[model samples]
Target: MKKPAVLLAVLSFIILSGFTPQTGIKPCYLSLKKAGDLKAGTADRLLADADKTRMLVTEAGEVPITVTEGYRIIYNNKKKAPFVNLIVELSKPENYEQDKKNVLANLSYLNAQTTGMETTGKLLELDYNGYKAYGLSRAGISEGETLGTFVIFPGDNMIIYIYFNNIEPAKGHFKNAAEYQGYRNDFIGQYTAHLAKCK
Candidate 1:
């Protein structure tokens, strides 16, 4: 398959798998109830707004998963809520390595494709639920004035990406660097809890 096609396939797999990864346990679909119950207040607040479906259409094709949904969150007293969408897929890393060389290569390609990028953090390899994964931070790539993160969890046959962005508020984005990192850490902690509860 072409590079893009293969990428899409891998992405599709990640999206289809939900948070269960490819472990022995069955994967669970995400929902407003599950998200709202999470100790992560921000996450609960975000998902509390809606319980809807999403269309995962890619050049490779589409994955039919009705549980996918979107939500809006009001941050820093902003009146306009940013629309958020979640896509889940299930697939394995065809060339995953201990040092994450494959992921680094892919990140390089993504960085090149990105324009107006202000900054990007180093890619860190970490484990989630006994599964090897990679996480990175970035900013200034979006022209829509969005600030957020991108995380990838590479599993045996499940690669999950969490794309989160918030529209720039009138007062500006996060209060400061510390505030941003705090939110990011909270998000990761809550997300891990949600995944555990789902299974």
Candidate 2:
């Protein structure tokens, strides 16, 4: 199969197995009730907003590259809310080691992708419900900066990226850096635990 075709297949598997709405089965990602203080937004709305800002090539010839947004949880569900976005991307290489290296490279590329934002702090290795994952931090250069924690888990032929960000910290939802970190960890733990149960 072509690379795009393979990617589509893997993405289809992920969506059907985890994100799709089905009778009696809860989704693997975070939900409105599970988020507690955070409010929920539809993935379709998030994708639409993203489409306005960036062009996403969904198809190439006969094959389609599916970009699935799992759960979009935010503070107050406002237009400009502190949010957590979950997205899955296809791994370029078939080999696990090469794919892992590519994931790290992609994380580094984030620093240069945006003019005012930079990926900062050390990349930490983590265990998410028995799956190996990596987490990195990001910050905006300007004042009233955005603080974010990005985590990725490499799967069979896909990588799951979860980004947690606070766009406006002065609102005082999180008292300190440690409080924000705790919330991020709890959110990740809940998500991974749900996935494990589904499996």
Candidate 3:
């Protein structure tokens, strides 16, 4: 497979892993009741609103159980309240080394990708998922790491990481960064579970 295709596959699996069995589909996300329940139109509408953009979800693609692929929705679903996720696929790192490297690069890229980027504090290094992890927090968000992080896998081919946090201006986007963190927490937890299954 081509590199882009592989990356797309990786992205899809990681997103889909968050859903539970009762979710109707194999990997459907639970809706936020407060958000007036999750409607198909909601995801579409959120994608349309740039000003209300505290989160985003785009389609990745999946072939289902046999081997999912194509285009599917990946976004930060806050309507269901806390714990949003990517669109689909839901795969995690089986190879620890590569996962770490790929993940770190993604986080670093986000600093460059997002608008008005300001990085504060030191880049923290630790260990998680059997790989050395490094977390970089933007300066203004209190004491904890609040921007993005990367998990370096064993080699250099694959790296697993997630980028999130409040970073919102208290009033707009997400209610606060902590709310964003809830989505991050969900993404990581489901991804970790997927990794266990892959192993």
Number of the top TM-score candidate? 2
**Residue-wise C-alpha lDDT for candidate 2, range 82-171, written one tens digit per residue:** 556665443323343554455555555544443434334335556778765565554331343445545555343455667765655455
Q: Could you tally the backbone clashes for each prediction?
A: 9, 0, 48
User: CA lDDT of each candidate?
Assistant: 0.41, 0.51, 0.37
Cα lDDT over the full model 1: 0.41
Candidate 3 local lDDT, 28-53, one digit each (tens): 23222222121122322122222321
User: Against the true structure, what is each candidate's TM-score?
Assistant: 0.45, 0.54, 0.33
Off by over 4 Å in 3: 1-73, 80-122, 139-146, 154-156, 165-186
Q: Extract clashing residue pairs from model 1.
A: 13-89, 13-90, 14-89, 14-90, 15-88, 15-89, 16-88, 16-89, 17-89
The alpha-carbon deviation from the true structure for residue 35 of candidate 1, after best TM-score superposition, in angstroms, is 6.1
Candidates sorted on TM-score, descending:
2, 1, 3
Better of 1 and 2 by lDDT: 2
Model 1 off-target regions past 4 Å? 1-29, 32-80, 83-85, 92-104, 111-121, 125-133, 139-149, 154-156, 171-173
State the displacement of the C-alpha of residue 80, model 3, in Å, after optimal TM-score superposition. 8.1
Ranking by lDDT: 2, 1, 3
Error of 3 at 42 (Å): 16
